[model samples]
Target: MEMNGSQRIEASREQVYAALNDVEVLRQCIPGCDSIEKTSDTEMNAKVTLRVGPVKASFTGKVTLSDLDPPNGYTISGEGSGGMAGFAKGGARVVLVPDGEATMLNYAVSAEIGGKIAQLGSRLIDGTAKKLAGDFFSKFSQIVGPQPAGDDAPAAEVAEKKGWVGRLRDSL
Candidate 1:
């Protein structure tokens, strides 16, 4: 399956790029992520639990980033196995562009799955993937966005202005 989209992050391009590469930040942003360990400047291992429809499984995977261009994004690819559930491998090319006070993160992704997960059907898998992606970006933006100086009210206002979900829906 192939999925592509972009998110408007409420931060500078450099800030967005840095957060994307930060293992701790990614671990928090990714839904059901158990852990993320950096093995090298451009490589990491991850453990994640995901549910696609009625099937839930744990995945252990390795991700590598290539085509380095600091503060401009890079290519990411990874593969994982979920025991009896299935296996999945995918790659994404990400690009970051400055947008005034914010950054626009664009990504194009393609993936393939096999075993029981594949039997669940493409529609289900596709929807689940999109949902996961949306969740990641939404959480990421909230973490990376500028915090209000002193109030919870302004935080909600910031979230509204960020419009992460609205942007994702528009892209899809």
Candidate 2:
């Protein structure tokens, strides 16, 4: 399957680019992510649990970043296995453009799956992929992007309310 979309982040292109390369940022942004460890500057290993349709499984994956372009963008590719459940492989080209103080992020993604997971039908897989992508970007924006005005709650109180993501941001 293939999908593409864009988002306007309330941060500079440099901030967005740096956050995209940060392991902690990604760990927090990825839904169902158990952990992410950087093997190198351009490589990482991750464990995640996901549910598609009625199948729920844990996936271990390796991700690699290529085509370095600083604050512009890069290509990211990854593959993961879920034991008997299936395997998934995909790649995405991400681009970041400055929009005044904010950044406009664009991405084009292509993915494939095999084994029992593939049998779940394209509609199910496609929907799940879209949802996962949306979740990641939304969380990433919330973390790296600027907070809206008039929210003056203390960091401890806000973190408690926002859960792990908020706590992670506060720690950073």
Candidate lDDT (C-alpha), each: 0.93, 0.93
The superposed Cα distance between candidate 1 and the true structure at residue 172, in angstroms, equals: 36
Evaluate residue 68 in candidate 2 and report its C-alpha lDDT on the 0 to 100 scale. 87
With a 3 Å backbone cut-off (N, CA, C), the pairs that clash in candidate 1 are none
Residue-by-residue lDDT tens digits, candidate 1, 1-172: 9999999999999999999999989999999999999999999999999999889999999999999898998999999999999999999999999999999999999999999999999999999999999999999998998765668867667666869996567568
Q: Which stretches of candidate 1 lie over 4 Å from their true place?
A: 153-172
Worst 10 residues of 2 by lDDT: 148-157
Over 1-172, each residue of candidate 2 has an lDDT whose tens digit, in order, gives: 9999999999999999999999999999999999999999999999999999999999999999999899999999999999999999999999999999999999999998998989999999999999999999988998998775565646545666899987788679
Candidate 1 overall Cα lDDT vs. reference? 0.93
Model 2 scores a TM of 0.88
lDDT of 1 at 86: 96
Give the Cα error of residue 119 in candidate 2, in Å: 0.7
Pick by lDDT: which candidate is best? Answer: 2
